[model samples]
Target: MARRGKKPKGRPVNGWVILDKPKGMGSTDAVAKIKWLYFAQKAGHAGTLDPLASGMLPIALGDATKTVPFVMDGRKVYRFSVRWGAETTTDDTEGPVTQTSEERPSRAAIEALLPDYTGEITQVPPAFSAIKIDGERAYDLAREGETVEIAARTVEVLRLEIVDQPDAETTVFEAECGKGTYVRAIARDLGRDLGCYGHVVELRRTSVGAFTEDDLVPLEALMEAAEEGRERLDAEAVEAGAKARVVDFAPLDDYVVAPETALAELYEVMLTDEQAARVLSGNPVILRGRDAPVFCEEAFATGHGRMIALGAIEEGAFKPKRVFGGRG
Candidate 1:
C-alpha cells in the first residue's frame, strides 16, 4: 500500500529575486527554479523573456508579487544583434525561417534608418508572444497554425544607437525603450522600413525599470551563495557581498526604489508625519508650500513607524503613492 496524501510545506516568505537569466531558459522556468530553491510562498517575474533571450529578470517572491504590475511599467534597455535578409516565424532565432532575401543593405543605409525609430512609434508585437486573443494565448493560437491579428501598440524609444555595424549582414545595436516595446518587432519593423527582412539573432535586456544587468545575480552563483547561507544574511551584508559577485543581489530595500524617487525628477514636496499618515490612509492632505515641490508621499506603515517614501504634492494636497514600511 502506498500513501497518497498531502505533504507538509511551510508558508513562503516575501522578497525579490533579481535573476541573471541565461540564454535558452524562459522567464517562467527561471521563476519555478527560484521558487523551488527557496520554497517561496509565491513568486512571479516582472516581465517575460523569450527562451532565446537573456538578461535581468526580476522575480518577486511573497508579498513582492503584489508589486509586479508597478515594476513592469518601468522602462527597459536592451542590446541585441539583428540579422538582415532573413525573417522567422517567431521573429527570433528560435523560429523557423519564413522568408529570406538576397539583398543586404550597407552599414550607412542601416544607420540612416535608425532615426526613423528613435522617437515614439507604433509597433506590433509578435504573434508568437504571450499576448491574449479571445481569452487564448496568442502563442498557443500561433502554434496551431492560426493567423492572429495583433493590434499595433505605441511605445517610446528613448534611445537607439548602433553599437557595431559589421559589414551589412548583421548589425549590433542598443536600445532603451519604455514598457511594452518589443525588440523583435523593432527589428522586424526596421527591416520593413529599410526594404529588407530582419530578425533578432541575439537579445539581452540590460535594464528594466530602475534595475539593470549590473543588479542581477547569475542563477548558478545565486544557488551557491544561498547554499553558503547568503539568504539568511542581513541587508548590509547582502549589499557588500553583491559587489564581489559582480551583481547587485541586495535585498528588496536596496533596489525596490520608491515611486517618489522617480517623481522627484518631476517635482519635490515635503510633508509632516501626520500628513503623510493621512495621505497613506487614502485621504488627501493640504500642504502649505504651493510653489515649492512638496514631498508628502509616505510609504511608511502606520504600525511599524518606519518611514519608507515621501511623495510630492500635485495640486494642493499630499498624495502617497507608495508606502514601504509596516506590515508590507
Candidate 2:
C-alpha cells in the first residue's frame, strides 16, 4: 500500500520560523519538517538554501508568507571557504573536479582581488543553480547532462573580505551582499582571477535581512515542542498563546518578527479605526500628515503598535497592499 501523509490540522498559522538548517538536508525538507511539526495550513521559506549549505533559513507560515518577497530582497551575510587549485562541476565540494591547478595566491594577492568583487558588478550565475532558463530549472538541465546557459546579472556586494587563509589550499571569506548575489560565482571568479581555479567547500549564511543566527531554532527542538504541546493545543482549540506555542520554537514566538518590527526600518503610518477597517477591506484612505505621497509606492502602516498592513501611499491616500495578522 502507498503511504499516506498526515493531513494538516488547526487554523491558518501566521508567523515566521528562522531555522538553523543543518547541512545535508535540502531547504524543502527543512520547511516540511517544520510544517508537519506545527501542522500548519501553509508554509514557505524566504529563500532557498543549498543542501550543502547550512545556517539561518527563515520559514514563513500562513500570513507571514505574504512578506516573503520583502525578506528575499533584503541583505544577506555569508561565511565560506574556497578550495584553491580545483574547480568542480557544481562549483562546490560535492561535485567532481573538472579542472586543477597548483597556483595558490597569497593573502595580499587575494586582498587585492577583493575590490573587484565588492560594490556593484556583473557576474554569471552557476549552471547548477535554481535560476530558470526557458521555463525550466537550470540545475535540472545541468544534472540531466544538458548544456545550461545562465546569463550574467548585476548584483550588489556591499562587503567582501578575505577573513582567513588557513593553508595554501584554502581561503576563507565573509561577504555581505544584496539580493541575487551568488557566493559560488564569487568563488569561481576569484579563482580564475588568481590564475588558479577554485570551488566552495564550505558555506554558511549568518543572516538574512533582520533575521540572524540568534533567531534560529533547531529542527529537532521544534518537533519535540510540537509533540509535547499537541495534546494541550488540541484540547484548548488553539486559544490565547495556543497558536504561538504550537509552533513557537524561538524566543517564545518561533522568530515571528512583527510586521511593524520587521519593517521598522521603513517609514510608518498610523491609521484610525475607520481607516484600518478600510485598509482591511482592501481600500485606500487619505491621510493628513504627509503631503501627496507617491502612489503605489511601498511603506509600513500600523495601529496601536501593531502592524496593520504594508502597502503604498497614493496621492495622500494609504492603500493596503498586504494586510497582516488577520487584523483586517
lDDT of each: 0.72, 0.82
lDDT tens digits, residue span 1-328, model 2: 9989887575566778888899999999998987877666888998899999999898888777877888888899999999999998899988799999989889999999899999999999999999999999999999999988888899999999988888999999999999989999999999999989999999999999888778778777766666555444564666554554453433334435554444545667788888877777778789875454566467877775566688888777787877875454
Candidate 1: segments with Cα more than 4 A from true spot: 1-14, 230-328
Give the Cα error of residue 64 in candidate 1, in Å: 2.7
- Pairs clashing within candidate 2: none
Worst-scoring 10-residue span by lDDT in model 2: 246-255
Q: Ten residues in a row with the worst lDDT in model 1?
A: 297-306
lDDT of 2: 0.82
Candidate 1 steric clashes: 12
Please tell me which predicted candidate would have the highest TM-score against the true structure.
Answer: 2
lDDT of 1 by residue, 149-230 (tens): 9999888998998898776689998999988888899998888777789999999987877666666778887666545543
Number of the predicted model whose lDDT against the real structure is largest? 2
